[model samples]
Target: MSAVQGLIPQPSGLDREDDVLTAEGLTKTFGTRTVVDGLSLRVGAGEILGFLGPNGAGKSTAIAMLTGILPPDRGAVTIDGLPLGGRTARTAKSRIGVVPQEIALYPSLTARQNLRFFAGVQGLRGAARAERVDWALEVTGLTDRAADTVSSYSGGMQRRLNIAAGLLHRPKLVFLDEPTVGVDAQSRGLIFETVLRLRRELGMSVVYTSHYMPEVEQLCDRIVIIDRGRLLAEGTRDELVAPLGDGLLRWELPAGAPEAVRRELAAHGRVESEDTPGGTALVITAHDLARALRAVTDLAVRHRLPLTGLRLDRPDLESLFLHLTGRAIRDGS
Candidate 1:
């Protein structure tokens, strides 16, 4: 059994209900501008829900509201059926672990000391505290370095320790905001493995927010895309990408490629043109890949437009983001 599995008992009875978190009509505004508007979401137990949005998309505001750090202008949030505020809110908050985008830790403290302090804050004490501190170290692969001060650790090691600190008390749900930021490939892989173990071994629910498309695509069971204070789409990757037809076919043409050629390619599928450093590029969302390729090649030959470069790409989360938000996720960030 994993360290998490060995530490926490299996949840039963009412805890088995799938919906671990529910937010209804959440809205947040600052001054004259509304940041998060009428946002609602649901995350089931043991599920990793990817929260995606471009910069200034109100992703931060929405997370604050959901975590009860900021009160929403309108809406209600409940964790494990416990509403936000009053005694119930405390109870609800106690069951949550939040690992922020920035590392929140005492640089002077050793890894074990940090976990012990955080665990105490969560009400773990005596033998329980010691056990949890040990478990956090073991699960995060920091057991050997438990005595070393956090300031001496590398960026990735500090990030791992941050996660270990949050898991000290073994909260039922976790909010990981860009946890893998600034880490190397090995550390990123370790973080991914740890997250997978959280759900697989301990049945913990996770709310993951990141600008990286591939991480969301690989880790999340379902994804929600939000932009300009509104939700654009929410579903599994396959479900969201299905409506864009098949894959994308892209061609590079000499600058000022004839408008007639553009129109002709549009006849094949949905076409969008952009001026690039090399030349003008035409992208076609193809329903029939074979037919679209043949038509484009034949047209290029007839028009005497040399095909500088050509590539066919399968539909993915990045494509879906571009289609829905009208811009690349990285560009906005």
Candidate 2:
């Protein structure tokens, strides 16, 4: 089995017809800087949409606008066919759940207590609230540990409880922001199963944000990538990676090798070189991997130069992301 298959169940081919959530021309600005610009997307019923961007990509700002937590400078959000503002704000808010990146559970409270509190906040009361609390606990696989203090639970358990808190009201749409940040492998697997079951059994729609590429590739029905708060690309895994071609060829050579080698390899494809721990790494992007490999091999044999390492990697989301957004590390919002 592939690495992704081991992490997530195969797609269930859920029929997602009408959209449960839609955002149009969403724009947000802080002082002179426009954080999110003309951002727009939609989520279909029972569909999982992968929301992606690098750090400081305005993704959080866009999400805030989508959830009605922060008002967009200009845009409209419709939830379940209702505008997510004014008289319908309460109704629209109730139909969606937000699982923030940070754990929102009270460490001092028991898991059950936390659920009961959030349930009440959602206007759930009496036996209805009790029933929902029980349902949330069961859905998150925390029934056995409902009475335990959240402070005592493992990081993964706390993460699950955080998810349960958002689920008490059984919203039609759920936004999960990096739901598996710090957890053991077992917990991550369980979280994946829980998310899949939500869509499979309850037909819930989800907008998932994660820095982990494999999770997004395995879990999302469609993907939307943003940078600087603007849409860069949106498509399925194959469609998104197709533009970059079949694969990349990387060769590790001595740091001070003659410039002639670099110039020669450039003829085969788009060649780029950068410093690496192994040595100076030469990366080639080409439409045809076989043709590029043949040219690279002939050049290497003719030169009779020692190669530290060489690898041919299939095109993937990570490559596409760096290609679109550049490789510079982003530290601020």
Candidate 3:
């Protein structure tokens, strides 16, 4: 019943349950260009907040601010109730982990060595460090290859090692930026499986950023969509998908349609796509796809333009993202 009780599943390996982090009015800029505008978001204990946006849309900038890697020109970010504006940020960051888009490891070092170095940097040493190191290697399925040089490891193995390094500290909040980017299918599945295990075992609160929509759709507990340096919306899959206006009704019209006929068809739906070879594909969002289809059919017959194709698109996260951004997730931000 608490505000923080937002679908957090009961899990093991968590010591004390607590809200992991929050960001309010978070903003950043360089000269005249603002990369991340004022934005507010929340990540609960043991929750994964999927951060989604296109290129240049400030996804990375927001991550930088949230992790304290880059100071914000405005607003604030806090972790474990520690303010992001000062020394508290540093201390707070020690309890957090980051899996960068690029694998963060020494190419010449073995996976175990790299993990050990990070654990040491986190101030872990001796028995505790060794325990954590072995646990992380095992969890990420890198134990057998732990002695392999990072440069000699396959891309997928290297990625697993990168995550292993992050887990060595057992951070309360982990920032995963494109962690599975460019990895093979098997490795990607392992990465997601590892995330699930971590969430259950550690009750770890995580922030994930990725261009892969299906991955986000499947893995994240919730999503925050941003575009052009500003937040478009934030909520769980249903909450965000619910307000995507309506389902899509696409109708393919005959070729070389005149303006008057086009205008008539346009009344039934928005002209979403068109091609001379493929005719005009019109899209109208409506709760009743059937009724909308009938209306379009009337228009087609009235104008004598061929109504060749039609389909109903159910509302979904991908559709939601597209509705807000006016572009596909893969489109440039």
Q: For candidate 2, list the clashing residue pairs, or say none.
A: none
TM-score of candidate 1 to 2 decimals: 0.84
lDDT of 1: 0.83
Output the TM-score of candidate 2.
0.83
**Weakest 10 consecutive residues, lDDT, candidate 3?**
1-10
Candidate 3: segments with Cα more than 4 A from true spot: 1-18, 250-283, 306-312
Instruction: Please give the distance, in angstroms, between residue 325's alpha carbon in candidate 1 and its true position after superposition.
Output: 1.4
* TM-score (all chains, Cα) for each model: 0.84, 0.83, 0.83
Clashing pairs in 3: none
Q: What is the C-alpha RMSD of each candidate to the true structure, in Å?
A: 8.1, 6.3, 6.6
Write one digit per residue (lDDT tens) for candidate 2, span 1-333: 212222222233223348898888899989999999988788888999999888899988999988989988898999988889999998999999999989998999999999999999999999999999999888889999999999999999999999999988899999999999988889988889889989998999999998888888998999987888888777788777765566778888876666787898777767777678756878877768898888777777887766548878778888767666664223343
Question: What overall lDDT, based on C-alpha atoms, would model 2 receive against the true structure?
Answer: 0.83
Using TM-score as the measure, the top candidate is: 1
lDDT of 3 by residue, 192-290 (tens): 999998899989988998888889889999888888777777677766655333567666766676667556545544445545466666656565556
Model 2: weakest 10-residue lDDT segment is 1-10
